[model samples]
Target chain A: MLDAFSRAVVSADASTAPIGDLSALKAFVASGNRRLDAVNAIASNASCMVSDAIAGMICENQGLIQAGGNCYPNRRMAACLRDGEIVLRYVSYALLAGDASVLDDRCLNGLKETYAALGVPATSTVRAVQIMKAQAAAHIQDDPSEARAGARLRKMGSPVVNDRCASLVAEASSYFDRVISALG
Target chain B: MKSVVTTVIAAADAAGRFPSTSDLESVQGSLQRAAARMEAAEKLSGNLDNVAKEAYDACIAKYPYLNNAGEANSSETFKTKCMRDVKHYLRLISYSLVVGGTGPLDEWGIAGQREVYRALNLPTGPYVAALSFARNRGCAPRDMSAQALTEYNALVDYVINSLS
Candidate 1:
């Protein structure tokens, strides 16, 4: 599953703007003009959950936040969390666009930089993504409306969009792995 | 060759206290060139020798911290230790490229290098050998030669550059 996503991500064009480019990403998301209130809310909630989890990690393991002695002080931690939020927003937008290409090299590089700054390992990020997927699944299970809405959004595009979303989520892990590997 | 040696020396000097990414890049570039030259020398002369060791020795000499004087125990020089690690990483880059074909160097930290080597489908022997070589002074009489250090310089450059 991850291998396929890795191939897609690596093969994707590298020209797209970074996920940190909030203004541009906002404009892109807004241009779709499609009311994905439920879907958007789910993504937002998942992102918030991950952010909170990271905060918990920070509080519990302050000493561990040192990448080769480059500690993530409070200010740096805050900035990293902010970047993580932006990454989630970008992920949501990419999911909506049904194009994994939306998460380009710039976006991945931004993610790598943020992770490095936070001194967070790839395994931790993978766990966070898992939490996100679990939360999203639970949310959909509890509210059939969100599932319906997601399906409607998928119907607007080819089934490939759905595949893209799955691939995007899978790619998230692989991307972090690559970043961590490169950091070494 | 002399120009690259000068560039590396200058970069090391400029990176007095802290070596940023750019500083490391410059140093790595020179090391790669030196490694390439050493590899070429080995291939042409058909003699197994520490061709790149001269460049490595020069780099160590310029950076006093890299001198193996039991200073690895001092916490005050962690940054210096890191610089030494980077040098080892450069050498590992050359070794992996020429002999291992695809393993990460020790500069990525031991865990990082281990993970990468595991992922690369390489036997544990080469990774262990490289780690041992990086830490110790004498060369092992293994199938691989110090010349591999010179051979893989270009490969390291490609790998590092492609990361970003």
Candidate 2:
């Protein structure tokens, strides 16, 4: 699995190969690294933004106006934020490590805690996570290179690395879903 | 305060049942008054040693079932339990008022539950599950059994009576 992941990552890296000048190739790699750093920053904070957006949507739908006529999430929204943070961290770890197996039983238990805290069934929790992902995706969509950078980060955290990290994270999520269902 | 209590009682009597969407305006009025009274009491009695005792006595007086409930021995404990139960009941009521209908309360999708949480100005995390549990247990007045329904009404009335 690691060999195939490595080859895939190497192939993806090769696709961005610079022609002619070695200095140009170095510059291209340097630029990609900068974009990757930006992507990481966005990814790290995406969960909080998603949680806040979800809370805003809820507050708007329910007409929960605060003293200032502005709606804000209460403590419960904090729980959702916590859950999102956990998922994002674990998924990012899995991607960076290029091994979903790193998310073991302990990790699954943590996921369960989020599901329980969110007070929704596993399926509903999954839907909520999907919504978060969509929100995150939308936020970066306007910047095509940044979006590509994010996509690259998912597949491989750095352009220099050669591992299908994104696929591992996807598998990790599926594994999480199975475990959650089994827990039920 | 007395007028608010009177209004809630009158509405309960007129409906011949616990308050529902049919008399939502009255229900909302009672809810707002109850909330106001709680806030006032909390503010006026701030840091007072006997505040919990007073709240306990008031709650037990209105809903005797709250009295002698095992393990709620101290005034503070009793007060805490009473407030928790009251909040739970009130959230359900708020959910019904905002969401309407008695059609499988637990089945409210993410959007639906969000609406309920938002309507109550509640936090959106564990409380969502808590609300889901209440809905699953048929906490809506119409969904309750005869005895359960009576107890629910008594609980709401107790809040109105205590606050007023």
Model 1 chain B: worst 10 consecutive residues (lDDT sum): B1-10
TM-score of each model, in listed order: 0.29, 0.28
Clashes of each: 1, 4
What does fnat come to for each candidate?
0.00, 0.00
| Per-residue error (Å), model 2, residue B38 | 69
Candidate 1 lDDT over A11-47, as tens digits, reads 3213211111123322322322221322343453654
* lDDT of candidate 2 over A58-172, digit per residue (tens): 5444533343221334555566556555554444333322234333432555666655674544544455555544444433232224654575433223343243224333443
TM-score of 2: 0.28
What would the per-residue lDDT of candidate 2 be over residues B40-138, giving only the tens digit for each residue? 222222322233334334445544443444523236765575555434334323222221121112322222545654675433323333333333333
> Cα lDDT for residue A163, model 2?
38
TM-score of model number 1:
0.29
